[model samples]
Target: MKFKALTLGILIASAGASQAATVNEVFNGKMLGTNQRYFESIAGVPRDSFRNDHTFVVQNCQITATIGDGKVTALRLDLGQGCEANLQSFIGEDAPKPGQTITPGVFGSGQRYTASCLAECGNAADPSAYALWQAPRSAGGMEVLMEMVLAGDKAMTAADEWEKQIKQAAGMDYVLATKFNCETRFNSIAEAVFKDVPVNAITVGYGLPTQRCN
Candidate 1:
């Protein structure tokens, strides 16, 4: 009986480690949930004939997540290319309702706006995670933003700016296409990045979004 118990414990621990190992490989030891941010500016012709040229300033330019207690709890990454179909899987939580206005500046004061279900992904639970569509409500490249926390840490906080920027740009947001849930967000992240990352390596989540100029 003792031997059996010992063997089972070993197997369980090994399996747990194996799961995180996949997610761990990508960072190569840098740290999973750090707040280090990346962003870029993408310019484009106006989607509307009368509108000015557009500038999409994407942030956390690369997919990155927060790690806590050796698990990936949160995520931040672009939602396009091979990353599109799987947006919901990573959500790990329910998504917000479509047309839900994720007002900016919870602590500070700004009225920037970003619309979720602006396209589609899954049922949102967290209220912050989003999968956006393209111009005229097509599949604009997608992206995911989540929260993170270490074990024993208090509740996690989102990295997004609270002040409103979008509406301030003289525009309100609406979902052009689909809505999403947490799992869908998770799956999408799984599809977006370098494949070697082990599953469940992240513990907490965090997110900061980019701005668009049109």
Candidate 2:
């Protein structure tokens, strides 16, 4: 279920699609629109790399992320069932404006921060997508990963349920890199609605890099 031998370091470095955007370039407010694409995490890799967060509603169909340097290095997204219909049903009204200070977790204003969450979407710049470029790592630095779904209304009960479910059945469904004996280290994400489509959950995982690809 994982490309344990896939080396993101190398894969992301070269073989990028003529149209695929870079990770750092994508996450830093350069939100991707429809018909856009990012670099593949691995070459010839199957797109079945999906997992559930709460074992209920969040289904990660595909994901692409970048890890390294101090920067978060990429953009993110999450899709769920029934999301292909309107796409705008989930884009809530509230979004973070520039110069806005929104803190997502327990870290100080220093180690804890987020990039731009709003940049004028195709319709009205909805809070359609918000992802963690980095997370608190266990080794000695930041952590973060990319995965998606949680597309219901922003209910604390639903969020709490998803969190509890993920914690209860962590690695089994939402795993990062199990090869380097790494554990999913990324956490704390915001609701993302694409073109009005609804998303349900997100999880960032970081622990180790994939083995270098040929």
Candidate 3:
């Protein structure tokens, strides 16, 4: 009986270790620069493949890998709304929730705005509320981009209210609006815009240098 119990404990420990290893390989950017053969070995054959891009489902997250020169150059994990729990578990207790202003260096070595231009200067596709993490070279040189969705009716209502206020303050001139500034406006009402918002997607890119968001 004692021997059986000891063996069972060993088996359980081994299983847990194996699971952790797999999770690290999949989620920690270890596979970022690996070749296709190595990627398949860890992630198994992808459910879908198109040219250099391969898509796989791991831990309920849809991950897409883009290959270049026979090595994975980029990875994107889409958690969607349903995988919030999974994301929380993976990112830990400090993970940013919708409407909360994410602190710098929370998800990567550095954090920055997601848009290429300031809020009003950018086109409709520009994301108003999102964070970017560019990891150091020692940490795989991958860019981690996380984006959030607003919290239903309340978020919309808050946005409408802000727009009204902005119009009042900045008037009808686009040039006047520049004085409001993206960072300043974002800092003022980040909580209202992103309150309880869950991250729906994360994209990781390897060999990508950090560029100034002009």
Best by lDDT: 3
Q: What local lDDT does model 1 show for residue 193?
A: 24
The TM-score of candidate 1 is 0.20
In model 3, where do residues sit more than 4 Å from their true spots? 1-24, 50-52, 80-110, 115-129, 136-141, 150-196, 207-214
Locate the minimum summed-lDDT window of 10 residues in model 1.
37-46
Index of the highest-TM-score prediction: 3
lDDT of predicted model 3: 0.53
| Model 3 Cα shift for residue 1 (angstroms) | 46
The full ranking of all candidates by lDDT, starting with the best, is 3, 2, 1
Task: Give TM-scores for every candidate, taking all chains together and pairing residue i with residue i.
Answer: 0.20, 0.24, 0.51
lDDT of 3 by residue, 1-214 (tens): 9999999986776556445534335654456678987776666658898987788766656777888899888776666434322223223343445434333334533355432322354345533335565555554344556654333454445444555565665664622343333444433443344433445566667444232422
The models' CA-based lDDT, in order, is 0.27, 0.29, 0.53
Better of 2 and 3 by lDDT: 3
